[model samples]
Target: MSTVSTPGEPQARSKPPIEAVPVRHPGRWVGVGIVAIFAAMLVHSLLTNPNWGWSLISEWIFAPPIVKGVGVTLLLTFLSMIIGLALGVLLAIMRLSPNPVMSGSAWVFVWAFRGTPVYVQLFLWANVIALYTTLSLGIPFGPEFFTFETKTLIPAFVAALLGLGLNEAAYMAEIVRAGILSVDEGQEEAATAVGMSRLQTLRHIVLPQAMRVIVPPTGNETISMLKTTSLVIAIPLTTELFFQASAVGNRLFQPFPMAILASIWYLALTSILMVGQFYIERYYAKGAMRELPPTPIQKWRRRLGRGGSND
Candidate 1:
């Protein structure tokens, strides 16, 4: 008996299998180059500017008004962020409102605030010598109108606060809207089906879930707002941190070191904010833990289960 394969039988090839050649991302090389350039520039600049020496550093760092200014900066950053966050939440809800008037009003507010330059907005607000400027309180038509002069009613600091806080609110609103929308619609539906009111559902379920999305960017915004508050110097408020620093620098003619010192404070504040963001993100992600992609063992176990069921 001859051992022969049929004519239609398939033949197997014995060639070695090829593996993928690893590719390094261009971004890594770009990042490395940037670090190298940054290091070189830093070294060169530091070496050339030996006068930012210990004494000058200590003096500027310990200056009474500058020290006080740091406190003011913190106060302003905290107050403005709180104001912005509250406004952001309200604006986001308004933007998502079913009523055309509310939605349109929110849209116009965001568009005007975000579309214009923030610095210009600050300056315009500072110059609020508008005719018939009343010390309006409450809603547009909620009825209590105690009028006062614009200049008397709106101080430079108040104007600056309103400008930056309101402007920040616009950007923050979009961020909040995106964050809330990213949450599963089912969550809201579940709350509704459970007999939760819209406000209650939003306050509890939607907000908790949405927080995971918002916290990170909100932290970043807080950090950015710290630096941005420097723009308040245009309003000529000397109590804020940068203003005091600039005053010292102007008098001493050491603007370079003074500016660098101010930059250092900004860096410090932002670094703290970054750490805060990390913790907040971790906290918000508690319910979102998912097992990572399957390993070989997992793959085989799943396959076996499927195959056994097929039997």
Candidate 2:
């Protein structure tokens, strides 16, 4: 069909077809560079390893009481962290509150906990002779039935629990605060526009978005809390991982090896937590990464490739 426009008639121009822009994957050089670095690291590790052909890994793993005591350490770490997480969230809210009294109370709690040596805090908790001298709540056998015995109430383990968990909460409150604040302000506004309450917006919208920023430090805190539980052995009532290991080491006169064994278990435990961190971070990032960020190389590749297309 030849439909040419006359000289006096207007000519119609065809619009350009929309094309799919291909994403620029990294070049072969990047993969080669990464492989070279990894190989160099592996070679260095092999060359510098203290034991080339032998291992005490089996002996380290099979130690009976040490293995069991690790369970206790894990228990203490997990329990305290659970408690600390709740306490931290509360304190974080209070610290960020508009009310002066609430914020001041939070500040005082953190100041006292972080100011004192944790060792001192543990000791004070273990010997918690009296939280308060007076029993203001009730009478022994009168109209008020409730009573708390000064001597019987505060046990050493309970004291240790309070000290470690509360101390951890103070540190974690700051971490939570920072994580919450790191969320974009626009998210809150959008959530509000959608008719969500402030609390609702914070819980469902802000916190979910802030997970990537929060997870790394929270993982570190978990590992730190695991090690910190060893301090509970000072109460002399219960045995933590280090306590059990140190006892056996002192008896056997293989103090160095036993201590090393304890450290190895701790590192293993922490490594597991680190792996969990990667998965958790990825889970949180899945939705966030829907709009992928263009890397620097991707930008340059696109710019360079555009030249070829234009030509």
Candidate 3:
């Protein structure tokens, strides 16, 4: 029921709605403006600078030799990574072994490789024929059953692979060991209680969980390996991307431009590897995370959907 107000009494009134103001981040805006200005300036310089020789870069970028070099680079990267990863796993297991001999041997392997410079190692591999003219397959301290010349057996390509792969294995061993150690001791104990052998426990229980740690560094190493393939020049492996680009530059008298072209290719390859690494990390994160993060495509799709609804 409505009530009538008494004459001359004070009247009640409704309060006006409050208007909210967003917090301003002036510092952030200033930083963004500074970055935008620098970026625009860089872009402008790139477009305007004739000395950069963009035309030369474009011309040599797709040349047959360059393409072949790219293929070689990829092959080297893939093979080296395979060697590193496979041997790294074995070394990591050995490092963690109960026996002192196995662990000590693994440690020595790691130490020797890690202590030396890869360039020096590559140089040594290339010149190894000087030290050993012939290698033989036979029982040690017994008559040789078969013999092969070291120079013939270890070519430039083979030397490059050995140098890069063996060096990478030393690094990968540490990475794998760190990943394995990241797994809880309880997980191994539980597996053992359930009648799992050491190998079985590592394979089924520990390694799976450890992958969350392992995949990231492994991905980084893969990308690093791609660039490090450039150092195969120490082996005088002239078929690699950087060496090919430099060769082209020397022939054309435009070394700087060719270097730029090689860099572009490296950047593109590295970007692709980075994307693959992201997905791999996500895959291994399944059990660890409550919800996996969305991919770039998924994020774009969501944004597009929201925009359409807004429209």
Candidate 4:
């Protein structure tokens, strides 16, 4: 028999309550355990190993020559990046030029530098004496404005700087070009409508917006340039960090410890660079995103708050 409900009566709703279930990831736990065990074993080995010569590492870590080498490495990084970025800006502007000749020249220069191995270029520059007896600043086959003996003028240090700076310029050119291209075309049109000159438009409007895209990569390049300074060893630049480390290691017959010292210094330098990069990235990120991402410290504080609440 079926029963009919009155028109004014409300029907009772019957449904089970929905409950959330936590997902199980046994594989993640297993992976974490394995990683923990491996880390423990590695730490134990490093601590117990006599062959590591921790004392020698400590001694050489702050040695006068190594300290000087660190300074030299920093100087090279600063100078190379400055020169590279300057040249890169010019090349990028040329690449965007209306003139085919300007664009073509920029392209060729970038292609030549990027195509060759940096190490080989360094070596060639170091031994450039074999290619040219003297280098001249004046027009080719014309009146000599100035001339320099190749051997005296292009020492190992100069060769290293030239190679690193020039090679870096090729990469920076591409980076800068990408940044320039990221700007809105409409922005440039609006600037032009306002009677802004091309240079004025680029300087005042386009570049400021482009920096949001450009800065992160530029920071990366700076860090990379810092590490690339180590490769100046190919030029046999004796004052550089890696060369100094190797020389000291060979002399002491404790190459492993010296290597460890170098690694420590490199790690410290990279840590400092990473912090600078973080701040620079944050500064440029302003107004680009609706909400800024939390920094590490903020994340930690949030975690602490959550943990306290749970407790």
Candidate 5:
């Protein structure tokens, strides 16, 4: 059918529809199948392995000594992280200071601590009484202040705490400094324009913004510190989980079971930490994001809803 338009009238034109395209991913199904098969095999081996000594593991799983060791390990991790965090904040502030001396001192501390192996440091701390028999308070090279024996002051637990906490402070300082740097320079300038001192600006504006960057790595460090607490054995801290479990194994001549027990506890603790980290990360992401990411539980529920709809 044909229609002629008048000279003053405009003609309406029809547009062509777009063609649809289907994407192909043939290897995706193959990769999924391979992963599924590997998972099945791993589960099968774990279930059927006879050398694991499941009976001994079950017996020692809730033993009083093991429970006590677990508690000590947790306590060390908590205390060390707290010390590290506080000391790290001071070091980070120092690193960012305008004074060259402050920055240099902070850098030297980080260099020394991070340069040496933590195990070696632990051993040295454990035997520090050899280098200095006594520790004292008051003026140095003057009238001696009240003195205390080094051995008396620094027992196995104290030595362990000192080694772990001091070493961790070095690493935490870098993490904190990076977090601080992630904040905008413009923000600092703006704060100064309003007559806020550097400390005040950091406390009120910068650190709060930096927390979003800080929290994730700090959570990772916390979990790592949990595992690193096992190294407290270098100080001969026999009350820690690794040492206690190994001691029990040596006594019973059943190393595998005791090792398994320790591993199970470590896994359980790390799993809890992972869940806590997830929630903490989500909380800190609030201001930076328009919408929050779905959690594992939410994703599962969404998948279930979709499946039900299909049915």
Candidate 6:
């Protein structure tokens, strides 16, 4: 059945399509503008400033002495971290041992090293010959089979290592302990139930899990060790980066620019360490995360794909 339309009746109308407006974040844009202004100011200052001695910095940054100094710095960082990590693991195990003597000894060692300043420790090691002119190897308080001069035994480099490595060991012990403690107690119990020995359980079960906790701080400590190599100057050891830069400054009568150069090198080395740390952390995160975060290359590929699709 058809209905007849009334004269002068309004015609049926369709509603207009809804407009979808995105929510605006004005504050975010304001914050970005503020940051950009500050960054521009900083860049402007770096470019315009005449006193920075950018020419001198470029000239000496790759100089032979500076290059050698960087090598020494890297060597010191690697060797010191090795000593610290190895000794720290032993100390941490001792600290967690059932025997009171082992735990007590570990505690005392950590306390002594952590209590003293590193500079003082370096100084003492440098002058250790004052206290022990000769060191002998044999039965304690009995006839010695061999003796050696302390001066010949402990060079300035060795003294720096002793100071830095020993001091770092104390700190690393605490970090290792924290990482060990972060593991679930039930994991160890399950390992024991499987007939694993204490050492085997710790090695296969506990330490592997603990590494997730341990690696981040250990990386940070590695970077700190790189910088702390500067304090070897207190041992009057002159082969490291900072000392070399300072020597160059004194020679050229341009101390401030040389200091800046040292800082730039330190920053560059630290950035490399940070990249390594990121990858290490990502590796350890595999078991913990259901899906790992994208790497830089993956992200770049994704962005390029999106851009091509849009085009």
Worst 10 residues of 2 by lDDT: 50-59
The CA lDDT at 302 in model 5 is 95
Residue 195 displacement in candidate 4 (angstroms): 1.8
Full candidate order by lDDT, most accurate first: 3, 6, 5, 4, 1, 2
Taken over the whole model, the C-alpha lDDT of each candidate is 0.83, 0.78, 0.94, 0.88, 0.91, 0.94
Q: Give the alpha carbon lDDT tens digit for every residue of 1-311 in model 2.
A: 33555566555744455578876657767998999999999998756775431144346556778888899889888888887888988898899889999999999999999888777888777666656543436554656555576446666667667888899899888888898899889999999999999899989998887777777788889999989988886665366789888887788666666777788899999998887776677677757677554545776899898886642
lDDT of 4: 0.88
Q: Which clashing pairs does model 5 show? A: none
TM-scores of the models, in the given order? Answer: 0.76, 0.70, 0.91, 0.88, 0.88, 0.91
Q: Is candidate 2 or candidate 3 better by TM-score?
A: 3
| Residue lDDT tens for model 5, 59-169 | 898899999999999999989999899999899999999999999999999999999998898999999999999999878788876899999999999999999999999
Q: Measured by TM-score, how close is model 2 to the native structure?
A: 0.70
What would the per-residue lDDT of candidate 4 be over residues 1-311, giving only the tens digit for each residue?
33555566566534445666767889989999999999999999999998988888887888899999999999999899998999998899999999999999999999999999988888888989999999889877888898899999988888988999999999999988999999889999999999999999999998888888888888888888888888877877889888899899999888888888888888899889888888777887777888888889998899898886532
Clashing pairs for predicted structure model 2, backbone only: none
Alpha-carbon RMSD, candidate 2: 9.1
Backbone clashes, each candidate: 0, 0, 0, 0, 0, 0
Q: Candidate 6: TM-score? A: 0.91
Quote the lDDT for 30 in model 6.
100
- Higher-lDDT candidate of 2 and 3: 3
